[model samples]
Every structure is written in C-alpha cells, then in structure tokens.
Target chain A: MTAHPDMHETESSVREFSVSPERLRLTPEAIERRIGYGDESAPDNVRAAIEEMLAVFDSADPFRCGFRILDPGQVAFHPDRIVCGKVIFRTGSIIGRGLKGCSALALLAASAGPDLSERGRVLISEGRELAGYVLDTIASECVEQCLEHLESELAAATASWGWRLSNRYSPGYCGWDVVEQAKFFSLLHENFCGITVRSSGLMVPLKSASALVGLGENAERKDYECSLCDREDCIIRNDG
Target chain B: MKETSSILQSIAQCIERGKVNRASPYPPDLRDRDGADELVRRAIDLGIDPQEILTDGLMTGMKVVGEEFRAKRIFVPEVLMAAKAMTAGMEHLRPFFASSQATHRGVMILGTVLGDLHDIGKRLVGMMVEGAGWEVIDLGTDVAPEDFVAAVERRPESVVGLSALLTTTMMNMKETVARLKEAHPETKIIIGGAPVTVAFAHEIGADAYAPDPPGAVDFLNSTVAEI
Candidate 1:
C-alpha cells in the first residue's frame, strides 16, 4: 500500500488532503485510556474486546483529515470575533489568549469516517452496549490521533519558516461557543473529509473534530491543557 | 453447607469473571465449564429462592464489578461483559421476577433526553443500576419530557436519570428536568454525560450528578435509602 495517499477519492466527492492515515495506528492502551481505563491493566475480556474492535478498525479505511494554511492578511481577530477569509468565529477569552501572537493560522478538520459510527450504532441495536461504547471511545481517540498527526505535519512545515504551531483550539473549549463549528466548516470545502457540521454545531459521524492552530514564531506549546481550564475532575488532571 | 449457597457462590463467581455459559470460549480458564447460566439453573432446581439467587448471586458479582469500575481497575468492556453474564443469569429468573417472587431494590426511569441520540452513557448506568438490584425502565434515546412524565406517572416512586452528550441537547435535558419537576416535584432527578458538570446539574435543579456509572449506582442507592 502507498504510505500516504495525497488525496482520498469517494463516490460523493474527492478530498484534497495533506495528512492521511498512513502514519496513523491505533494502540490498545490509548483506546483503553480514552474509554476510562488509566494505567490499570485491562481485564482478559476487555482486552479481547479491544482486540476484536481493533481488527474492525484495521480492516476499515475510517480515517482522513484536511487542512489549509491561510495568510495572516486573510485572518483578522477582534475582541469578540475572528474573521478568517470568508469564515467568522465568535471568540472567547481563551481563544484570544491562545491566538495572541501568530503570523498565520491553520484551519483543520478530521474524521474517523462514518463507518465507525455506523458500526457503533449497529452494536447498540444488537444489544451489545459494551461493544458499542468501546467503539465510540476508540473513534474519539482515533480523531485525536488524527489531530496529533496533523500537528506533526504542521510543526515540520512551520519549522521551515522559523515558526511554531500553537495548541489546537476548538470551539467548545475554554468558553468558546460551540456554535462556531459552523463557521469552521464554512471555511473548509464542502464535506471536507466526510465531516458535516450540524446546525447545532455538532459534527456528523459524532466522532469528528475541528480546530484552529496558530502558526508563528512566538506560538507557545504546553504539555497539556489542564492548567488553562477549571475542570477539576478531568482524567488528564488526575493522571498528573 | 447448603447446596444452594454453594451454587449461588459459583454463579456469582461466573458473573464476576464474565463467564456466560459452558459453551462460552471467553476467560479461557473457564472454557467448557459451568457458567452463570448453568449454575443459576442448578440453583433454581435446588429450590434456591429466586430473590436470593438474584441478590446473593447476580447482584453480588455486579457489586464487585461496580466497585472495580469506580476504582478504575476495570473499564467499559469488562463491565459490559459482566453485564452480559449477569443478563444470562437474569434471563432464567425473569419469569419468577415478573411473578413478584423477586424484589427489586428500587425502580429507576432512565433515558437520553430529547434531541440527544447518545445512549451509551444511559445504557451503562442502566445496566449498572440493574446489576445493583434496581428495576430499570430504559426509555431509549430522544425521549421527551412528556414521556418522562408518563413513565413517572406510572411509577410515582421511581427515580429518574437523564443523559445528553451535546452542549446543544443538554438544553433539552434542562427542559426535561423542569417538566418532570413540575409534574412530580418529589421525584429525584440525576443527570450525567460528557458535557454535564456538577455546576450544570445544580443549574438544572437535578438532585445529583454522577460522573461515571459507579457514581450513578451509588447515587441511586443513596437516594433509595433516603426514601
């Protein structure tokens, strides 16, 4: 198989993409962690279930991401809103603080595809609630993995310009209204990576994610976002 | 030792390890051995009280699973398998339970509030609560406030649980809570989901907020005790 296909062609449309699943691999521990297992050893049955679901994931071509680097001239940040090209975002304190210093921005959207979500629903209909839950959790992690891979690609690309990529910030994080998901989708091409933003700002496939990453020389990086938020019982905080 | 007690203990072990039946190939060590189904049947044949089989056998195993889940010693897949094993045993006792031979700890009405299609959290809590000895009435996802009211009208003493995974649909949960409170002010309402918070629960006037399935089980048990 080709290491990374430059684009994915589908019956409905074609995706002109940069990051692909060629470098993406799902680890059992990562999926287990997303499903609420920390460092604890998974039981025999749970491990078997993880293996079973992993086989399904391996067989299905369920991952894709699309991104574009836009010039700073096309993006403007106001006190309450951000205008990137034709798309506008209602900004919050966290987003303003994160995007403080940047020369350009990278708008990215990623999905683990609809097949995984469909499989999860099928499991639920079959009364396999556990299997369904596991699938959902794994799908969530897969999108994050896609984001991580995108970041790596962005980081390398930005380094060539003596710039760094800021942490990926999504609409729902840090007081940003989730309604901006529509705005994010508007900036991207139609059905980009098969992720559709619902009217309510929720994404289809239920496991897709969209975010903005600031690119500049002064962009800061953190080990985790726990310190910036007030979620006291966050598993990431507990892990630390 | 009474033969029934021994059989009940074995059944409880089978449920804890997620051994469904003699034909199950899981938990390789127990493959080709009597599982929860066979032991439950043998206990029934030995005249073990169905209620005792439920509380001492199925519920006992589930309690351990719940505690382990709380401690993060196990995750969803393991608890689900345990639920499956418990279901295998419960299937044999369903008729007896329906005939009023088995007593439930309490009645809980569970659903994913309207406009929310997410049911994974609701189902986990339902299975966990049922395993903890409650009779759970699961109203599948996209349940409206009127549906909750009608279910509450049928069982006025039942506690209600609402779940929503979206910031958008979480507003619907608030509406369902408000409607249920207006119709049955005394009914306890517990809310949970990915976007739900303790502050949000208080804002929505929910009686309690459960962060996980075990937390929900604990909340339900405590609420039942209060009543």
Candidate 2:
C-alpha cells in the first residue's frame, strides 16, 4: 500500500488524522469473538446488551490519532533498542525484529478518548457489568479500528516512495516494554492526539494505543500475529 | 417449608442458571420461578444452617460455573450472570456471616499491581473467587507494593492475587511479589493477567499462576483445601 502524498511532508512533521466514531465499523462477530462467544452466536442477553451499548456509543467523545514520520537518519535499529531521533526505546528482540531493515518509522498515537472508558467504568461500578464489559470491548475495538484506519492512510502516504510498511507494533506487546512509552511520546508533540503517558507508563484515559510502523523499500511487512507471542495467558490469545 | 434438600437444590439451580429472583426475566425457561434470592431466603427462614446454604447452595453452583467456564461450555456473560445470581443469594447470608454463624472458605486480596490501570480481568477473577465462597478484598488498580504487603498484613491468612496486563507492569508485579514475600514469607501469592505466564509466576516467586478466572478460582480453592 502506498503512503498518502501529504503524509511525507517532512521528517519531524507531526500530522493529525481525524477519525470519527461513525467511521468505525463495530461488527457483531468481532464483538462476539472478543466477549468470548467463540464461533457460537451471542446469547439474547448479550445481544441486547451489545445493542444497548452500541446505540449510545456515539455519545462518547470523538477519537483522535497523530503521527510523525522519522527519516532514516532519525531512525536507528538495534538488536535490543530502537533509537527514534534522540529517544531510545528498549523494545527488546520482538520489536527489534519487526523494525529490522526499516529505513524510516511512522510513530503514531491513537486514543478512543476518555469518555467511553469513563462511561464503562461507571457502568461497572453501578453493577451493570455485562453492559460495562460490552462497552469496554467497544472502546477497545474503537482504538483498534482507529489504528487500522491510520495504518491505511500511512500505507497510501508512503507507497509513492516505494516504502512498504510493516504491521503496527505497540509498547506492552510482543515483549516490548511499556516503560519505553516515555521515549515514544517524546517523538510527538506535547499531548499529541490528547494522549499522555503517566509516570507509571499508563496512558491516561486508559483506552489509548500507540505504535511504530517501520517503513522501507524492502521492509518485510511481517504480520506480527498474537499467536506468535508465547504469552499463552495474553488476553488476545485467550479471547481467540 | 420446602424440604431442606429440595430448597438447597433449588438455590443451586437458580445460581447455575443465573436466576436472580422471581422478578428476574433471564434464562427465559425459568421465568416466574423462585430464584436464588427467594430460595435462599426461604432456606434461611426454615432454620436451615447458613453454612449449608453457603456450601450446599452457593458454592455448589459456583463450582459448576467455574468448571463450565474452564471447559468453555460458558463464557464471560454467562459467568457474569451466574455471579449476579450468586451475589443475590450471598446477600441473604451476609447477616449470618457478620454474626459469625457462617465463614468464608478463605480470604483473597486482589489488585492490578502498581503501574497497571487495567482492572477488568482482575475484577472478573475477583467475582469468580467471590462466587466460589471466598471473601475477596479487591484493592482495585495501580496498587503499590507496600499496599499489597499492608493488605496481607491485615489478614495474614489471606492469599494475594496480583494482576498486570502490560509487560512493563509485570516488573511492578515482581516488585510487589518480592515485597509481599519479604514481609510475609508464608503468604500465598497468585498472579494472573494477559502478559503473566507460569514462567513469570515462577520467576517472580508467586505461589501459583492462573490463565483465566476459573483457573484462579481453582487455585484458591485448592490452596484452602490443602490448608
């Protein structure tokens, strides 16, 4: 996929991508899979709860995403760390492997905003746990959808440069240490996309996601599947 | 009054089917029937021992729910519904427990370790453990290592469960476990979360590792049984 022309403006330029909740496609099957229905259809109560949550989902705040493209000089790959500009991310082997052979990097941060996560938390506290869980799943799906949308845009933006983008890899996944989040955010504008990493490495709003997309003419474009992760206890693995 | 065995069986059934009360419209097949709420109340009014209701009724049904969940016969929504039903019944036993007429199998102190804000998984494990008739003291998310140590200090017999979804936070889990272990070496600590594994559990000196809610319930129950 080719990167959009406008996305290649400058190496240090941080661009915002507007993705509306309306743009997100929350499929019933995807929700079912996440909530542990497996291949079976969700029960009536589950279906009703999902419908209710979906009906009010638009009331949540708008989603936000921002990205900065780093040139080859600004990006350096190591077996144990990835240096983006002056910031060094100790991503370990899993992330280092993915960034191998990359000439540039697209650092992106995306969030479902705070409203949905807050609403879900409130619902759980009120004992509407089933509905709360459904909302949580929806919020997570929203972030994933936002990331997917941004990935496509990045794809179209870099394709002209003959750059192939690998799948997005986020901190706290594939053995990447989340402590590197501080360095990750340093590459972006202050509170870029309205997301902030706490001292604990937790992004405020609780539903935010960040990742690095390696871009190079021959960047293998490896699909970092969750199954490859040995953490058998990982939620995504259990959800599947 | 209904036969004691029959009432207890009904209470178990209500819990298993997620029937909360006669007013609850779930499980369509059991509509209008006396649910855990009514059945448990009736059992108590009949002078049946509260301990029996807890063991023969709530725990009995929750055991099945845990097994079904482990076997994947049911999922989160179903388990959640069942926990609701179990909670409805447990409400009736609260006074008895307070009066020392009934007792929890064991106490569990659970939390998402320091630096981790993720809590849904921890809450799920708490609900399952509570449904299994353990008293769960949930410390919520981003709990400090000292907080865990202090919690276990309050209830020395309590088993601690540390949870974290992020790999970075797993370091915090290790720290929490070490602090708890240092303070109370006898304290049994169990750890679980998306990024947590048996190897990590071993690395951090945790007493056990549970991959899912049922696994947590099973681990806690087994520990108490051993005691």
Candidate 3:
C-alpha cells in the first residue's frame, strides 16, 4: 500500500490523484453530466486547456503495437496488447464511446460507404491515427493491474483451480457486432462489467473496456486469433 | 421505539436520509446533529457490544440504502453517500474486526469479469457488502476465469460475485462462471450490476443473482444459515 517513492511525481499522476480523497469523491451526477459530450465542442476555456493536455496523449506511441476490426460489422477498430500477464495486468483501453458502445459504431454512425475489399474494410478515421493508438498503452497498464488484483483473490477462491486464461478478444473481433454490444452485455448480466450504454448506445465509464477470453481449451488458439486480425499493419498488436 | 431501538432506528433514518455528520447540509431537516457516526459511537460508550451495534445500527442503516437502490428510489451517488455514512460508523470498529475482536458476517470474493475494466459498480458493491458485515475480498475489475477459480480454492465456502459493464465483456462472465463451477461445485456464485438480470444469472448456471447489494446480503445470510 506504500506509494512508490516518486510515484506522485510521475506522469501517470492524473486528475484523480491531485485531489484529497475527502475532496476527490466522484459522483454519479458528475459522470452523468460528462457522459455524452462527444460531439459537443469543449467550452472555449476547456478547449484551450484540453488541447494543451491532449498533446501528452498525442505524442504517445502506439501501445507497443495495435490493430483494427469492428468484428462482424466490418467497421471501426480496436488495437490491444497483453502487456503483462500470468500475475497481474497493468493496462488501459481507449476509444470514443460517442453515441455508441464502441468506436466502430461511431464510425458507422457518421459513415456511408462500401468496402471495395471483399473482406469489408473501409477508411473513416482522420489522419494522425497514431494518437488514437496511445490509449492502448494506458489500457494495457490498467488491465495489468486489474488482472493482478483479480489473481490475488482467485488464488484464494478455488484453492488453485489449475486453470489459466486466454488472451482477451472482443465479440466483433472475428465478425461479431463489435456494434451490437447490447447483446453481449445482456449475456454478462453485469452489462460489460457493470457499465452500459444509454438509449443512444453511448457507453458509460467512457474509457472502459469489454473483452472476451476463454479458458483452458480455447486459449490454445491465442495465435489463431492474432494472425487472423484485419489490421495486419498494426505494429503494436500483441502477436501472441 | 425505546431508547436503544430509537438510537438504532435513528441511525437507519440518517443513513436513508444521507446525513453524514452534524454539519452535513444534506437532508436539511437533520442539520447540525449527530448522524450514524456519532450515534454509533455513543451506543458503543453506553456499553452495547460492538457487534450488535453493527447488526442493529450500521447494518440496518445500510439495509435501507440498499433497498432504496434496489427500488430505484436512489442511484449510485446517493447509495454511495449512505455507504460512506455506514463506513463512518464502521471505522470505529475496524481494529476490533481486524483482531477477530468482532466477527465479519461472511466472506465474499467480488470482481468484474475478464475483458471488462469498469470498477465503479464493482467497487460500490464491495464497499457496501463490506459495510454490511461481510468480509469483502475485492478483485477490482477485468478479472479472469482462473482468478475466480483460484479464489474459491482458497476459501472453499466463500460466495463469489461477478460484474460486467460492457456487452462484450459480459459474455466473459458466462465463461468465467462455467469455469468456476467446473472447478468448484460448492462455491456459490452471484452476478450483478447494471445489465444483469435474475434470468441471465440462471442462464450462466449461477446459484443466485441480486440486482443490488441487499439482495446479495439476503442470499448470503441464507447461504450461511444452510452451512
């Protein structure tokens, strides 16, 4: 529970850490107000501030490597990395939840086009695509911590179930809705780990993630999921 | 209610009203007076056993909040306030609980299923469950199947709860639940959070599903009784 000596001085120090816990209590009301401002322009002062801070994000590298696919819809993309595993996972995932649960939906919402490629590929993103990729690194770090804490508890749950995990994948990864997240959420019953979309399909926990990984037998296909990806050019996507 | 009953009842009322302290401006009616924290402390100094203080005072307060949340009379922020009030009372007894000087109602291992990383909902559940007298082992978010199975192995009879906030990750809950059942038949599994339903709970082969914290506590009480 001890903070690393210079942890407070590190770049990882985001807004949450700057406030005292007594003053830092986040509220649902705040989240509700912030949830669907995707297309709304930031207030002038806010825009001025964010554009400055956005650079920290813009200069960032792709998460070691990343990829593209909206699953079955053949639109949007998600680039991921295992970063760390077998113990704990420290990772982050990023994408605009906009008016849909996944960016794939966002692209679909704004796009009207056909794929010349037989595989259903389309170009919808603005240039400087690498900026979008930086979020994956943050996601990987966040995920790594989540996995670590989970592992500690699981170690106590089954007295050692002797099971491991499969690499994480999304529904649309192979040809699923990556768009109809509502379907998969209904199945989880936690609504993608307890977050959900509005009537318009905007996901709450704006920067959160939803993935699918198998156990034992299915995980053996990790490499299969990797090689079959649509963003074959993505340099950060975990090949394993 | 008599003096003791009134004191306990007051605690529950304050919690339901979201009055945190003597100075809290919330529930303007209760302005400038002791809330759960002060009342709970006074109850302790008056010679009440800490455990009864918890079950009768703090737990009762939490029960009201949990019910309100279930009824949609309140949402996450309000529920969180009530929980914070409950914790204010709980902080007084942490050492006792830690020393086995007080008993935790039961143990719950909770987490968000793998491929999902939303923790607010899961954290709320963990906090409220812990405040309600259970020993909560929170695994944060994005938990994998092996993690669930492993935790069960360590605490054979403990209850397990899974959370998922995304549709994509929710499917992983079924995979996780299936894996846990395959590994430990006796482990009681409960699933909850925004998109969950009792029907979906059954679909995953889970033993129970609570839409909110109180329902989970009720199921836990039953599970403990059966033991």
lDDT of each: 0.80, 0.84, 0.53
Which ranges of candidate 3 are over 4 A from the true structure? Answer: A1-176, A179-205, A208-240, B99-101, B195-199
lDDT of 2 at B38: 94
Worst 10 residues of 2 chain B by lDDT: B1-10
CAPRI-style class, candidate 3: incorrect
- Clash pairs (backbone) in predicted model 2: A2-A155, A2-A156, A2-A159, A3-A155, A3-A156, A3-A157, A3-A158, A3-A159, A4-A156, A4-A157
Better of 2 and 3 by TM-score: 2
Q: Write the per-residue lDDT of candidate 2 for residues A142-202, one digit (tens) a residue.
A: 8888888888877777777888887788887777877778888877888888899976678
Candidate 1 error regions (>4 Å): A1-15, A18-23, A36-40, A77-91, A127-130, A235-239
Q: State which candidate has the highest lDDT.
A: 2
lDDT of 3 by residue, A1-240 (tens): 222221222222111111121222223222222322234442232333234323433333221111111122323223332211121111113211111222111000100001111011111023211122222222333333333333333223212333334344443434333444454344332432335654323344443344443222112323344445454433234475
For candidate 1, the share of real interface contacts preserved is 0.46
DockQ of each model vs. true complex: 0.45, 0.64, 0.02
User: Which regions of candidate 2 deviate over 4 angstroms?
Assistant: A1-13, A78-81, A96-101, A223-240
Compare the candidates by DockQ and give the number of the best one. Answer: 2
Task: Provide the clashing-pair count of each candidate structure.
Answer: 0, 10, 59
As a whole number from 0 to 100, the lDDT of residue A96 in candidate 2 is: 74
